[model samples]
Target: MKHWTEDLDDDGDEPLVRPYTITGGRTTAGRDDLTLITLITAQSSSGTDTSAERHALQPEHRTVLRMCGRRPVAVAEIAAELDLPVSVTKILISDLIDAGRVSARPPLAFAQNGALPDMTLLEAVRDGLRQL
Candidate 1:
């Protein structure tokens, strides 16, 4: 018999679950520190033994971890990648942080005491985006 998801797409792609279900019906993130540009990274390094904990996470949480596994990613980017609203994405990320699955921090420009970002750094970022 064909799988349930096969009927949803000709290419067998899975359907996206409702955003509310993904966030467990909650409306707000556990922490208030998250912002659109906040950087998030997975805590599981190459040799880390977090498989047991990993197995307990929800599928959406796993997806977030995988997306940020390689490098620090902005929250806005994560939201876009997950195809979920920014609010929902923040809640999911907050859950991961609470479970020690991932960590988050403000971007370098925002880390300073309300100081503006360096022009050279901004230019470099623009160049990188252009390359992408």
Candidate 2:
């Protein structure tokens, strides 16, 4: 039986590019507003054929725009989808935002003004659970 490694083709051995290279070696996104839960979406006015424009952008940037084009997505989710660090995702998002190709907004704030959940609803749920 042949080993799995033997079945794979090897080309002498070239060093793989680093992840940071995708962000142009920038460690910081340079924006203070970006957070893990921040939402991003493609700007409708950015023009059609985003794929055509993507050819001019880096692969990472193109991937992000493509995902956002469908609907709003969270920063953390984008990072997970692309298998990139959160910081790197933020940097790429920042670039798209700066280019006016995408829009970013913080997660929706529920119950503004320090409101609390109704205790009656909680009690009802507790009673239902107990009955089960």
Candidate 3:
């Protein structure tokens, strides 16, 4: 099967920009709570004209915003999809969060204190999946 990154490149070669450059040489994310499973979703533009905002973002930032715009996506998934280092993806996402372009939250399936979810809820989810 063809590798996914091949489609992203105009030429069959490695990317010209390094991950550090993409993240402005930053190695750490602004938020310490961001985990691999953290869910990210785009913030609604509401009354603001988002076209202007879109124009100001870098291409990679815009791409991340577009991915999060559709639905909640996991931080790991974003890194994989963009073929960027997880650190780089987190930095980009952190910038968006700071700019009010996206929001991050823990996965709903996760319960507090690393405890298991209620059996009833899992059964209900299984039943819903069976219906689908």
TM-score of each predicted structure versus truth: 0.69, 0.67, 0.72
Which ten residues in a row are the worst by lDDT in model 2?
107-116
> Per-residue CA lDDT of candidate 1, range 22-129, in tens?
877899997889999999999965576568866778877888989999999999999998878899999999998987778999997677777887899889999999
Number of backbone collisions per candidate, in order? Answer: 0, 0, 0
Rank by lDDT (best first): 3, 1, 2
TM accuracy, model 3: 0.72
Candidate 3: Cα lDDT at 123? 100
lDDT of 2 at 84: 83
Candidate 3 lDDT over residue span 1-132, tens digit each:
998887774765576798888888889997898899999999887767568877878788888888988899999999998888898889999999999889999887673456677899989999999999
Clashing residue pairs in candidate 1, if any?
Answer: none
lDDT of each: 0.86, 0.84, 0.87
lDDT of 2 by residue, 1-132 (tens): 888899777765532556678888899999988889889998876356566666878877888888998988999999998888899889999999998989988655532544656789989999999999
**Structural RMSD, model 3:** 8.0
Better of 1 and 2 by lDDT: 1
lDDT of 1: 0.86
Model 3: per-residue Cα lDDT at residue 86: 90
Pairs of colliding residues, candidate 2: none
